[model samples]
Target chain A: MSTRLLTKYATPDESGQAILKNAMEKLDLSARAYDRILKVSRTIADLEECENIEAHHVAEAVQYRSLDRSGWAG
Target chain B: MLVKTFGAAVTGIDAITITIEVNVTRGIRFFLVGLPDNAVKESQQRIESVFKETGHKWPGKRIVVNMAPADTRKEGSAYDLPIAVGVLAADEQITSSRISDFMMMGELSLDGSIHPIKGALPIALQAKADGFKGFIVPKANAREAAVVKGLNVYGVESFREVVDFLTGRKEIEPVEVDTDAEFLKEQARSEFDFADVKGQDSVKRALEIAAAGGHNVIMIGPPGSGKSMLAKRLPTILPPLTLDEALETTKIHSVAGKLNGHISLLTRRPFRSPHHSVSDVALVGGGSYPQPGEISLAHNGVLFLDELPEFKRSVLEVMRQPLEDRTISISRARFTIDYPASFMMVASMNPCPCGYYNHPEKACVCSPGVVQKYLSRISGPLLDRIDIHIEVVPVPFDKLAAQKPAETSNTVRERVIKARAVQSERFKK
Candidate 1:
């Protein structure tokens, strides 16, 4: 949840682990909760009418769920 | 017998007179039929209790209350006193022919006191337009509504007083408001006195030009560089509200239930600074029933979005069209509502994520890429809409401590008012 972790580990191009991390904290979800982030990412993909959840879409969705405010902020 | 009277209810900013039909039937039940919100539905209990306290028999028969044009959702408890008065007057318990000449509105307490209702100015204007002799609203709202001339505006304290007045048992004087005084007060407080701000004279001059031209502005500054303080003061230096502009601004606040019952028109321009966390629905305004959002609330005034980059991109992006068109039209499957949002935008943001990236006296820890990315959070198209952009530097310690009677708001405001008058004359042409 630290800003440093977002800056260091999370890339704007990849989904990384922030979504799963958010689901764990917000939903007290287990590692299995990665699927929920995937689902949400899929929904956003559908909104854009994309054939699949592209790397950027998933990454954006994950960024949206970031517990570290810095990662999601512009 | 069914007795009918009409008073206005707001659907967004537009007010439509509702037909209040009270029928005292020959049964032992009471029914209120309308698409009333919980607040409106609860009026029955309030009305009946007031009846008991006033020593009037709650019509033992099946009493039916119908708010006609019922398809339009009726919210708020303002209808309670109207319906109560309608029932009492209909039953001939309180007799007065004057009821037909006036529009009555207020929320009734169980003990029969009238509580203030929102949108008094709009409702009063609507009543006047309908050619009603006068309007009877809560005493608190009377002054607000009194801003409307050519109409007798009565402010009543208790339901008993309203009942007594309407029945010719007592007389209530109509309220009067000093709109000129309100206007003069507005001319006195210039938004952010440029004199008080010691440094950043360039930024202040830019703001002055923006205020003069009615242009959107953005300020990029490090934390505690007086960006917020400057934004807050913009309204003071801007042009005063014309009577028409004041009425329009007052209507939006009324619909949002933001009017705090000053009982006079808002002569000052509005200044709305919504937090970044505000939802799209709350910012642009939409519901099962449409209400004004922040953009509409900021009409005829300034809408300051501080920490602009921190706001959700989607939420900020949605404002693009409204920013260009000066109106927001929210379309649902069933209905579409358009709210006026012709407001001057003044948004502020930090140079980087840490808010100290470009501080003159501080070290820059954030990389250049981080600064660029933070600025990119606010889309390019949105940035294009803003006419003025300036960077604010921190004031020196000496300037902050030295107060040799900085230029007061009144002096700066006079210049702004003059510029506004120029705009008004040009627009009229």
Candidate 2:
């Protein structure tokens, strides 16, 4: 997705913002990962028929990014 | 005498019509010009042999056959038919005023039989766009050429048939196809479905989301955890290819010579799983002639890289440009060609070298340093292109033994389609 589409379609809500902010603090994600999380949350919200990105949708997408890779499988 | 016939040279996924102009003057030798490669120049021998074998009087005059638009290098033997016919018509052996009404492409055999040529669909499309009266391709490529409407398509078996058709000596039926109906006939059919799997609801959900959003995915798990199996079934739940998407995909396949013997239109989303040993050129589309590679073959579909880390890092690196731009551009010193490669990349890798890093039952035998080494084979930049990460766990024996069928891909596809509808509506601005 282009940056224009990313900002237009996947901007998070206030509560969703805090959830992402918390995850960023905890996980030390790269700056590039911030945009992907929003895109995925937008998809999750779309799947659930939500017009706006919700806290839980952002939370779910965040969890996918934290899945075990160099560590133990979650 | 001068004769003009038409053929095409496939550059990238499209074709440019090459005018085969044959001019016969007072001399004995043949001269082929207009930047033709060795294969095209060698068509003189094949054309001569076909004339001799079929007992057609050869025009012993100086035959200067030129493929016009002098800079474009004509590469293949497919130009054989047009060149042969141009020579024959110039000598008035096949005297027809309507010869230029059709675009022709086929390779001639020693005994004058016709062989299939590549890019028949694109050539057919270009012919229709150029308002040609017809397209004459080999019998084997008829179905593909027939996919295009508003043009006469004649599939011929031998050079004799072409001559007869052009000279009005015989009538050949133009191929008729209801491509829309043909595409819809098998649109919903899938060779593999989600219901075939016994368990793993979470993994299925991730794949569903990925399909709905056209997002890339990565599967990390131990061996025998159903990663490859799940990756193979991703296309089943993908929304079926639209008519335009199918045509685009089929054109790429056609120009690559991969669809000569396959169906004219691809009804389902393509699921291509090239082996990990694929080279940089084969993975991303580059060569001397520059054929569409596996990624372009998987356009408007899925490209599953099974054992992702097993692929050479350089091979993986070449995909980064197409992943971002949705198209790959190959540039030589003289020219450049771009092939469309918009595809969902679904890749898989074991969590560790021993393939059991976090198995539910089997203990991982690889050391910590070894596991890190295995993970680093896939670079971070490439991994960033993947949108979703799924950790596949092997289903237990009881779950595998359950006789109840899981949710079918058709059912999942409904929701996926619904989700995509919402996306399109949201983006309708």
Candidate 3:
């Protein structure tokens, strides 16, 4: 017998993938930001009555990082 | 003739019934017994003066007043009305069979007017629990007692009115307050709103999250950055108080005598901002007779500590346990009492002693290690209990003067409610 990990929900579609990739490369987003963006995107999708995370949802979630204070002391 | 009437003694936010027994005999002296404090003992002079001014003759015979539960120390002048009534009834000035049906408490002025007494709510609650039909209190305290259902609360103006009501010459209507309707009607009217704040959208968002999750938050900023202003509006965005929470909070205020004769249910969340020079006992609640302090007074609401670093470290340290447990326990030699202290802690402090350590337009004057030392004054254990930390910067003039309206607290509150719904669903698993 083989053990397998359980996947709960469907993965994001192609447009969502493109938006996340663009945010990572252009904004130099870290892994934590990546997770936060996904969580926020899920919330945005839930708010918009969508069953899956969409590209516009991820874009809206990425804008919440303006308050991030990473390496501003120098 | 001998007569018995009832009053209540408050002990740690609860009330215990005290029986006042008055005996009039054949002498020309007066006596007051029981383990009463000086204030309770002083009720006799006030009662005598009140009776004389109200056109009632003081009994020429000897009078003896004994407060039951002789072992427990009764404090405060709340026993004045009961003692006076007992004397009047024993002297045959007011003959009524219904004197024992009501629990009466008030402080009597020399002019015979009834003054408000502390702990009316707890006394009313005890009356209801003990199967009393009605409670007679000062007009200022009637509504406080009226919050307790299944009990008639009579608010009287003078000792004459109490006499007339007891003798069935005049009927005094009990006060009535629809607690739920009043709470909903007044909860929407906050004096300070987030829309009035010109800028600081990020700080507002941080506050919204803190309010949603019931998390402790600390704001780090320089002076004139609107940290204190932002904290004051935080309560306006949090969830409205349920009727049970409002009653509980009102009871704590009633015990602390902070209601100041506003006898309505505390519909709005409390916002307590103690000064930096507050003592440890004043913050956490302790004394010879333990009373609710700032944290307990802020029950079901916000406790904002402005200039958090300036507070004595000892005072701040005393709040650590209650901040985690949401209740404070004060222990004495014979007993320990618990006061509900569940409050969201919102604190603000400048970055350094000079208040310009990290200003955008200004240079830092404090040395490198000074800022760290200033921050270190707030101990690690105290800071560990706070869940959120956000830094605030001054808003530019253009942002402040902009005509475009920012989001209101109601708008943020709606989103917060939805977020809380999601969190509750997730936590239910």
Two-chain DockQ for each candidate model: 0.01, 0.54, 0.07
lDDT of each: 0.74, 0.89, 0.84
For residues A1-74, what per-residue lDDT tens digits would candidate 1 score against the true structure?
A: 12343233222233334444544565343332244345444434433444444665555444332222333223
- Compared with the real two-chain complex, what DockQ does model 1 have? 0.01
Residue pairs with backbone atoms closer than 3 Å in model 1 (clashes): B27-B61, B27-B62, B143-B263, B144-B263, B144-B264, B190-B236, B191-B233, B191-B236, B191-B237, B192-B233
State how far residue B1 of model 2 sits from its true place (Å): 0.7
Query: Would you list the rank order by DockQ, best first?
Result: 2, 3, 1
Residue B370 lDDT in candidate 1: 87
In angstroms, how far off is B26's CA in candidate 3?
4.0
Overall local distance difference test of candidate 3: 0.84
| Candidate with better DockQ, 1 vs 2 | 2
Say which docking band candidate 1 falls in.
Answer: incorrect
- Which candidate number has the best TM-score? 2
**Of the pair 2 and 3, which is ahead by lDDT?**
2
Against the true structure, what is each candidate's TM-score? 0.79, 0.97, 0.83
Q: In model 3 chain B, which range of ten residues has the least summed lDDT?
A: B420-429
Q: Which stretches of candidate 3 lie over 4 Å from their true place?
A: A1-74, B27-29, B60-62, B422-429
In order of listing, the candidates' clash counts read 10, 0, 0
The top-ranked prediction according to lDDT is 2
Q: B43-126, model 3: which lDDT tens digit per residue?
A: 889988998898888899999999999877899988999999999999998899999999999999999998888889999999
